[model samples]
Target: MTVTLAQAINRGIHDAMEADDRVLMFGEDVGKLGGVFRVTDTLQETFGTDRVYDTPLAESGIIGTAIGLAMYGFRPVAEMQFDGFAYPAFEQFTSHLAKMRNRSRGRVKLPVTVRIPFGGGIGAVEHHSESPETYWAHTAGLKVVSPGTVADGYAMTRAAIAADDPVIVLEPKRRYWMKDDLELPVTTEPLHKAVVRRPGTDVTVVAYGPMLKTAMEAADAAEEEGWSLEVVDLRSLSPIDTDTLVASLQRTGRMVVVHEAAQSLGPAAEIAARMQQEAFYHLEAPILRATGYDTPYPPAMLEEFWLPDVDRILDRVEEALDY
Candidate 1:
């Protein structure tokens, strides 16, 4: 069936709730309103208010409640509504949700999934569009995963919900309506493994979430220019499938990292450092980054200039090939 990224995620949540009565979903407007994006539509009606309900307009409280429910053996799935809003709950994520397992010396398990709609492309307001995955990826005890396609959206959401450890699912809000035809209950690679979306030999472009689409577009453009570009989707950010990345780099011999987040201290930086450390001899040129500037997310009108696009990605790819 043809399913959109948003609908795929809704089905994933629905299936999880159906399979496990212990699974619960709650967030602002998630119950009756079905979420601002309608990703949670019909869930409340299907499961009723007992398991699927709405919470106050407090990000911290939502996360805190999820943590408590998790401690009590309930696998709570909390939604942060937007990317920037998750900052208010950073304390709960780092100090409590992430540390609980270790603090209890392996006796406590927090099977909590925090869903965040992230990235900039919908011409949203400042706080509405922000890439905060870096913060969650940097946290030690959390698993971070993002899906670029409709199938991965459903598969990754299910994996995140079933994981015993805390997980942060970064949904690419810009691609919510992006659709594809696929069967239900689709399962791909393991949650932490990266996959090569397009194979090429000239250079490897590594990206995830919203940037995956941009990278694939760049690869298509590069083919017309006589450059074979390999696009790798880093599905899981925290654990980072380094082996897959290194193998791609060894074959391609050149690499360019792309992301919507600011270049400084972003996921690109970590990937570049790891590639150099593990496969420096295989690199044909210095790792280049096509990303946003260090400045805060630009206003809606100026976001076009701030966010990375196919042109920027190709520019970096050309530079890498030229070297």
Candidate 2:
């Protein structure tokens, strides 16, 4: 069956709630309004107010409460309405949610999933379109992941909810409407692994979430220009599947990391550093990145120039090939 990425996520939440009595979701506008993106549409109605409901307009309060709920054996999914809005909850997440399991010496399990709709391309307001995955991914004890495809959106959400550790699921706001013909209960791909979406030998392009499709599109377009680009999706930001990435680099000998976030100090920087350390001998060219400008997410009118797009990715691919 064909389903949009948003629908796939909705299905994932439905399956999760049905599978576990302890699985519950809460966030701003998630109850009657069905989330700002409607990804939680009809879920509150199906699961009832007890299992799926709304919370006050407080990101820190929402996450702080989820941590307590997790301690009580409830697998809570807390949504941070927008990427920038999640900043207020950083203290609760890093201090408590990400530390409880270790603080208790493995006696406590934090089955909390913090779902964030992140990245830009929708030309929305500043705060509504920020890519902040690097913040959570860098935090210790937090397993950070972002889904690129419809299947991953379904499977990874379930995987995050089932795990005993805290998981941050960053959904690409721009790619939510992307549709694919994958059925529910999708492929059993591990949440922490990076997968090759397209194969080639000339160059490797690494991306995830909002930038995955753009990378793939650039790869396809590169073929007509007589270049072969392999696209790898880094599904898990933290604990990146470096083996998969290094293996691809071993074959291609060149790579370009792309993301919607700023290039400096973002996930791309960490991945590039890892490749330099792990696959330095095999690299034919220095790793390059095509990412958002180092400034604040630009206003909607100028976002096209700020966010990474097909041309930007292609330019990086061409540069990698030229080197």
Clash count list over all predictions = 0, 0
Candidate 2: which pairs clash?
none
* lDDT (Cα, tens digit) per residue for candidate 2, span 1-323: 99999989999999999999899999999999999899999999999999998999999999999989988889999999999999999899898888888899999888999999998889897799998888888888999999999999899999999998899999998999999977755875799999999999999999999899999999889989999999999999977999999999999999999998988899889989999999999999999999998999899999998888889988988898888
lDDT scores for all predictions? 0.94, 0.92
Model 1 compared with the native: what TM-score? 0.99
Using all chains and alpha carbons, the TM-scores for the candidates as numbered come to 0.99, 0.99
Query: Could you tell me the lDDT of residue 285 within candidate 1?
Result: 95
Which 10-residue span in candidate 1 carries the lowest summed lDDT?
181-190
- The root-mean-square deviation over C-alpha atoms between each candidate and the true structure, in angstroms, is 0.7, 0.8
Give one digit per residue, the lDDT tens place, for model 1 in 106-178: 9999999999999999999879989988888998899999999899999999999999999999999999999
